[model samples]
Target: MASKLGVSIVAVLATSVGVMLALALGLISLSIAAGIFLVLLVAMLVFHGAAMDFTSGLSDSEAFQKAVEEKEQREAEHEEWEKEYWGEHHPDYQGEEHH
Candidate 1:
């Protein structure tokens, strides 16, 4: 999902640059450039909607659930490791709040 958005953003930027270059070169008029930009915007929106629908469907699947659970478990393990590491490395640290 994030990658899709990133790609779309890149595409929009590239298109904008291309359109600007074309307009500067007198290859396309301002009205034509605006129309092209509008079309690209609409296409990006449609792609975003489709991507959302696809991701929503995946979220309800067993594989997606398992992957999420695995990710959470790994994060918990990493947190525990970090706490132990800090405690051992800093003897004066008591893992408490300081005022």
Candidate 2:
């Protein structure tokens, strides 16, 4: 896992790059680009929690383990949902052809 500080910095830099790319590509107006950057920065802050300093923490705690399990479950559920949705909506879906 990456340190929180490193992730935070990457998030900020990525957002900046995204905004600049969008503007340069004429995908968004300057105002909308700024809004996008602001939204992404706020999302990063929320997703990363309020910790400003990165410290080596124990990953063996029950809470940490449970959180990881929950995250994995959510990802699995999302993957299933995507498969189902695409299978229903896509014409070229292989599973549907087999059925």
Candidate 3:
């Protein structure tokens, strides 16, 4: 698929960069070392963001509010039904029970 192709492309590019740096600097220069480290760091950042959406909780607030409202509505309806159907016959009711 497209995703596989993209990954393969990135891999090839990164490998090419690493190999060229190794060849140019004999693997001991600060510039090449820093470049490799930066590339790795960026790749890690992209991976983390893609997997977990590390956006500081911005996306879930509205959905959380909607869920809370729906739960409250369901609880209110249940309470109303309980009052209509069982309030008189509930054992804790102080006055009487229907025979």
For all candidates in order, the CA lDDT equals: 0.85, 0.74, 0.68
- Give the Cα error of residue 26 in candidate 3, in Å: 29
lDDT (Cα, 0-100) at 91 in candidate 3: 46
Tens digits of lDDT, candidate 3, 18-60: 7667857786576766777677768766765664553444357
Write down the RMSD of all candidates, one decimal each. Answer: 10.5, 15.8, 10.2
What lDDT does model 3 reach? Answer: 0.68
Q: For model 3, where is the 10-residue window of minimal lDDT?
A: 90-99
For model 1 the local lDDT of residue 63 reads 72
Tens-digit lDDT string for candidate 1 (18-99): 9999999999999999999999989988998888887876555777889989999998897777768778887676655333
Q: Which residue ranges in model 2 land beyond 4 Å of their true spot?
A: 44-49, 52-99
**Predicted structure with the largest lDDT when compared to the true one:** 1
| Candidate 2 Cα RMSD (Å) | 15.8
- Which scores better on TM-score, 1 or 3? 1
lDDT of 2 by residue, 25-78 (tens): 998998998788788878777756645222234445766899899999998897
Clashes within 3 Å, all models in order:
0, 0, 0
